[model samples]
Target: MKISNAHLRSFRNHNETAFEFGTRVNVLLGENGQGKTNALEALSFLCLTKSFYASADATVMQQHGTFFEIKSVLLSDKGKEFHVRVTYDDEKKTKKFTINGADVEKFSSVIGMFPVVILSPENSSITFGSPADRRKFVDLVISQSSKSYVENAMEYRRIVRQRNMILSEAKGKDCSSEIAPWNEMLITYGSRIIGKRNQFLSEFAPYIAQTYLDIVDERETPKIEYAPSISIKPDSSLEEIAAAMEQKLAKKKNDELRFQTTLVGPHRDEIIFSLNGMSLKHFASQGQHKTFLVALKVAEFFFLKERCNETPIFLLDDVFSELDEYRSRKLLSLAESLGQIFITTTSEKIFGGAEWNNERRKFFIKSGEVAQEPVTA
Candidate 1:
């Protein structure tokens, strides 16, 4: 799917702005704080039904405005079109995500329809940052491709929250029986999450390894391993996994009461990134960290495409500056395999004039405004 047009109102610094796009490649050029990244974030909203970076709807709303809206049309390769819109109200803290003017019941229904892959500087944290960063990366990829996974993951988080509340509320001994229902719920939901996470890692491993090697052009083998808080027996069935989770949670009851938190589950898992059998965070240089991050995104693109059976809209959000000429060209060339790409850059000269198609529309964004940037050789 390709975004044909995007209109943003009161989002970030953008009070009102709209721009049409080319089918293959669309570039946004501007200096810092000129709304270049905001445009891409708007496009991400159209696809993902929320801002890619902002944690809450209010964070993305313009400081001077109380509400923000993003509307766009997505065109399929078969010439079909989908009208998508996302709106947020600050006072109510409400968001409306819709397609064809019909409210979307859940984000899962909206995700696979307009699959997206985003690569930005912040993604570097996936390599050098905490385990939560890597887990989020995993969830975003798997959720887009599988609706069942989405439901299970959401339910898992809710159960975790409820369990934590019970832990905090208790003030006496032997509250294990009080939290019993929550433990069963956790087993029910957490097992599914862990199972799906392991399956995704199994599918995504080779792709990441191959892509990382190609990006770094080095001999070191990159590996991604799922280290779950609950051990998943390879020989065990789903029922057996649930039983194991229940048993483990029962065993950790004393520790759970002592700490006032649920300790054993996928919520505490980690995605270990290693090269040559050593942790990437400790052994890799800054440049190597950046390369590994891009490789993960590139692998995510292919992973979603393979699972969803459609090309996902790829967003490169001003990350070209992190790479040298060769790596930048490598990224662009890899992007060419997909049907549509959106790039935000501060320097128009990064990719060079010859690299962009004359028909590939380029836009200059400034002060929340977007207009066509003329293509000249």
Candidate 2:
């Protein structure tokens, strides 16, 4: 899928702006604190229905405006056009999504319609960041690719929340009877999530390892392993898992009351990143970690392509300027081969005129205005 045009009104620094995008590479050049990244974020919000940097819609609205709107025309692989509009209001504290002029009741149905993957400079530190960051990284990518995984993950989180509430209310008594129903729901949804995650990683591991090997030119292999809170027994079906959870609930009744939170489930799952039997987070150099992050993202792009049968859109936020010449070239080369890519940079020098081609387009962002221009080599 590719975005043909994007219109931003009362968004960030932009009062009103509309610009057409190239089907291949489109670069947004500007200085720091300019609206280069904001334009990219606007496009991302249309596809993902959320902001990457801001937690609240108020953060994305113009300084003096109370509302923000983003409109885009997306062309699918089959030449079908999808018009998407997303509006946010602080007073109402709501986000509205419309596709083809019809309000979409469920956001999941709109996802994967115009799928995209983003890599920003912050992603470079993800491997070395907290476990929650890593889990979020994996979950966001996997969730976008599979709606079932998304639904199951959502249901699992809901069950976890409800069970925790019940634990909080059960003062000194055993909540075993009350927790049984939720435990069953958790296992049903949690197992599906775990199973899908495992399947994705099984297919994702080889691609990631190979890409890392190619980038590092090393003989050692990289490995990604799922570290779940509870060991899914070989003979234990979902029914059996639920039963085990129920038994564990009885055993840990007192502890649950003391902690006032649900424990022993997928909520505490993790992903282990290691290379040559050494944990990457602890042992890998800064450069190695960055390369690992890139490989993981590329593997995600390919995985989506293979699964969805459509080349997913790519968004790079000032990442080229953070990399060395060699790594930057490699990333741009890989991106050029993919579908539509929107890259933000503080300087045009990052492109270096080497990646410039007819299919690539360049735009200048100043304050809130976007000026369309072609790269001159």
Candidate 3:
């Protein structure tokens, strides 16, 4: 998919900004804190129905403004166009998303409609951070690709929260009678989530491996292992997963009361990344970490492209700043060959010897505005 154009109003530092994007590579060039990332965030909001980084919609609104709006024209791979608009009213604490003038009541439904893959500096945590970070990364990728996954995840979270509340109120006492219904619900939804995650990890293994081989010349074999909270094999059926969850819940009943939290669910899962059998977190260098993270994202792009109806748009936020010239150019070449991509960088020197045309244009951003004419060279 390609974003043909976008308009931003009262978003971050952008009081009013408009963009006419290219079909291939559109670069946003500017110095730090000049709203380059904000523009890219707007595009993400347009596609995902929420901000990529910000936890609250109000955080992205202008300081003195009570609302924010983003409108865009998106083109699908199958020669279809989508007019998407996202608006927020801080006064009423309401956020609305519309596609082609029709209001989308459920934001989850709009997820894979315009598939997207995002790689930002914050994504470094996927490799170097805690297991929760890794789970978040995988969850987002899976959520976009599968429609039922999001709802299952949402219901699972609700069940966990309710169960935790019951445990907290029990104060280390046995509350089996009160929590019985929630326990069954937890096992039901939790098993579905674990089964889906297991299936996704199994399917995604090959994509990451091939992408790593395609991008890196080294003979490195990357592997992702799904360590669910419950004990089960990857090929375990839903009944087996549910039975395992029930057994674990029984074992952790006293511990859950002591901790006052749901302890036996996918929420405590871990995803380990390894390079040639060595743990990425414990053994990989900084370069290997970056490369592995990039490969995962590229793999996500292709995976979503095949799973979703539309080709996913790629967003690279200030990634080239950390890479060497060779890898930067290599990534640029590879990204351009993919579908439409938007890259944000502090310098235009990365494109020094690269080809540019109407399909690959550069926009200079300064003070939340497109500063000058798009550079096409």
Candidate 4:
């Protein structure tokens, strides 16, 4: 999908800003804290119905501003147009997502509509941070590719929260009677999540491997293994996964009572990334970590492009700052080869000797507003 234009109001440092994007590569160039990243975040909000970095809607709202709104014109691959608008009211604490002037009651329904793949400095956590970070990375990719996975994940989270509440209130007492129904629900939803994760990881392994091969010159084999809380094979069926979850919950019941939480589920699962048989988190250097993370995101772009009906848009937030010159140029070429891409950076030197035409454009951002005269390389 391609974003033709976007208007942001009261979002972060952008009091009121408008964007006329290029059909291919659009660069947001400015020094740090000049609202370069904020513009990219607004694009993410328009596509995903929320901020990629900020957790709370109020956090992204401008200081003392009561509301924030982002509206965009998106074009699908088949020449279809989408008018997407996302608005949040502080007083009412309501967030609304509308497409083509039609209210989207369920925001989750918009997951794969305009597929997006974001790679920012924060994404380094996927390779260097804790397992929860990796799981989040995996979940977002699958959530965008499969709407059913998104629904199952949301329901599973609610189930776990409710189940944990019962366990917490019991205060180490036996609450089996009260938690039994939740257990059934948990197993039901949790198994589907795990099953989907299994299928996704298996299908995604090749994408990552091919991406690594395409991006890197070395003969390194990147592997992504699913470490579920329950014991099950890679090809385990939903019934088999459900059975395993039941067995695990039975064994962890005592521990759950002591900890006052739901112990056995996908929430506790781990996704291990390894390079040539070595764990990425334990052995990879900073450069390797960045490379792996980039590979993962590039792979995600291809995966989503193939899985979703729309071609995914790639968002790179200050990503060039983290890589060497050679890698940066390589990534730039790769990103340009992809569909539509939005890049935020402080330096325009990377675009040196690069052509800027109708398909590629640059915008100078200063304090949340685009400069009247854009500086071209």
Candidate 5:
């Protein structure tokens, strides 16, 4: 899929602007703080229904503005067109999503409709970051690719919150009986989440490994392993896993009460990345960390493509400026062969005069206005 046009109103520094986008290799070039990233963030909001940089919608709207609006025309491979619009109201503190001029009650239903993956310089440190960051990374990718995974993850988180609330209330009180129902709900949803995560890792590991080798030029194998809350053999049933959770709850009841939280579940699960039997987070160099992140993102693209038969839109936010010449060339080459890619850059020198193919287009974004232009060497 590709975005044919976008209209922005009171978004960031933009008062009102509209521009068409290329189907492939659309580069947004401008000086720092000139709204290049803002354009990319606007496009991202259409896909995820949330701002990537701002925590709240009010922060994304221009000062003194009451609301922000983004509208896009998307064309699918089957010759169908989808019109997506998102509006943020500061007074109501709410976001509204519409598709084809019809309001969508639940944002979840339209979240992955036009899947997108963003590779920013900030994402380069995901491998060296905390386990929570990696978990979110994995969850975001899986959630976009699989609706079942997203549903299970949402349900698991809801159950966790409810269970923790009950635990907190039962602290120094006699409300322990209420825990059973929430525990059952947690296990029912959490087990599916864990199972899906494991399955994703099983399929994703080899792809990442191969991509890492290609990018890093090393024969040393990198491995990714899923670490769940409970140990269950590969062939074990969900019922068995739920039973194990029950035993864990019984074992940790006193601690859970003391902490007033649910301690064991998919929320606490982690992913282990190792190279030559050493933890990558602690041992890998900065360059190695970047390579791993790129590999992980490439694997995400392929995984979604293979499953859905559609390539996801890629957003590269000033990542090329951080990489050396060789790495940048490799990334540019990889992007050239992939689906529609929207890239942001503060300098045009990074692209090194790569010619635009029939599918490629370039845009210049200044003060939140986008204009189509030829990329200069």
Candidate 6:
């Protein structure tokens, strides 16, 4: 799968611009603040129907532009074509995402349709940040790889919010009976979430270990363990896990009223990463943290590919500067085995030893405009 072409209109600083690409290494070469990262942001919105950096959709539109629109023509290796369009109205703050002119009722339905993985400076949180960051990465990967997971996760979140509201309303009142319905929904969805997360870690751990060794030259990976609110066997059936979660939440009802929040579910779960039985987030050096994050991302790509049977379009957004020459080369080496790649670099010197195939295309982006000529090395 590949994006054959894309047109960006009124997005960020790009008033109007379009580019065509093939299935190979394509470099968006330019200096800082040249809209190179902005282009990648557009592509991200096209794939995910949301912005990773922006808090809202319309914020990505240009100040003077009335709307932000991006349209891309996706081509599959099977000789089929998909038209993906994402348009946001600045005035009304509405977003429309469609494939082949058909309206997309839910964004998750189309997330994995054009799967993409991004390596950027912003991903540092996945390694050195809080548990929420790590859980987000895990949820995103699982959501794309499994549509049922997405539905379950979404329903779980909805149930959490409803449960929280009920707890708040019952803080000093006698509404215990009303909250039971929410708990029933929560247990149904939360158990599935916990079970899926536990199962995912078991399946994905080997890839993380191998990728960590291949990239960081480490003998052991940071030990990954899924810490759920309710304990269950790795092979526990969904019904069995739900029963356990239901009983646990029943015990926590008094505590929930005391805290005025829902406390017993996957939302409260944590993924602990340790090395040599030491907490990696607290004990690992900065370099070690970065290597673990990179390894996780690489493992993410392989996991999605193996599960989905399609190589996702890989995006490396100004991450070379974050890595030394050796790791940059290592990342490039692994990426070459895949399909389309969009790498943005502020310095051309980084490509001195880089290899590009016959299908390679390099161009310069300046002030939201794409130049046909490649920037000089």
Best by TM-score: 3
Worst 10 residues of 6 by lDDT: 368-377
Candidate 2 accuracy as lDDT:
0.80
Model with the higher lDDT, candidate 4 or 6 = 4
Q: Which residue segments of model 3 deviate by more than 4 Å? A: 375-377
RMSD in angstroms, candidate 1? 2.0
Off by over 4 Å in 5: 172-174, 356-358, 371-377
Instruction: Give the C-alpha lDDT of model 5.
Output: 0.81
How displaced is residue 149 in candidate 2, in Å?
2.1
C-alpha local distance difference test of each model = 0.84, 0.80, 0.93, 0.91, 0.81, 0.83
TM-score of each: 0.94, 0.91, 0.98, 0.98, 0.93, 0.93
- When summed lDDT is taken over every stretch of 10 residues in candidate 5, the lowest stretch is 368-377
Q: What does candidate 2's lDDT look like per residue over 1-377, in tens digits?
A: 88988999999998998877777889888888879889989998988788877888789999978899999999888889999999988789888999999998887766666778888877755688876677777787787788777777777888989989998888756777888788778767876666666666677888887777766766767888877666664344666555665566567667778898876666776778988889999999887788888888888888877777677899999887768887788888888788899998876765775455456778888888875555544
Could you tally the backbone clashes for each prediction?
A: 0, 0, 0, 0, 0, 0
**Could you tell which candidate, 3 or 5, scores higher by lDDT?**
3
Off by over 4 Å in 4: 375-377
Cα lDDT tens digits for candidate 6, 226-246: 888888877889998899898
Q: Candidate 3: give the clashing pairs.
A: none
Kindly list the per-residue Cα lDDT of model 4 for residues 48-144, writing each as its tens digit: 7788888899999999999999999999999999999999999999999999999999999998899999999988878888888999999999989
Q: What is the lDDT of residue 85 in candidate 5?
A: 93
Q: Pairing residues by index, what is the TM-score of model 1?
A: 0.94
lDDT of 3 by residue, 117-229 (tens): 99999999999999999988889988999889899999999999899999999999999999999999999999988898999999999999999999999799999999998
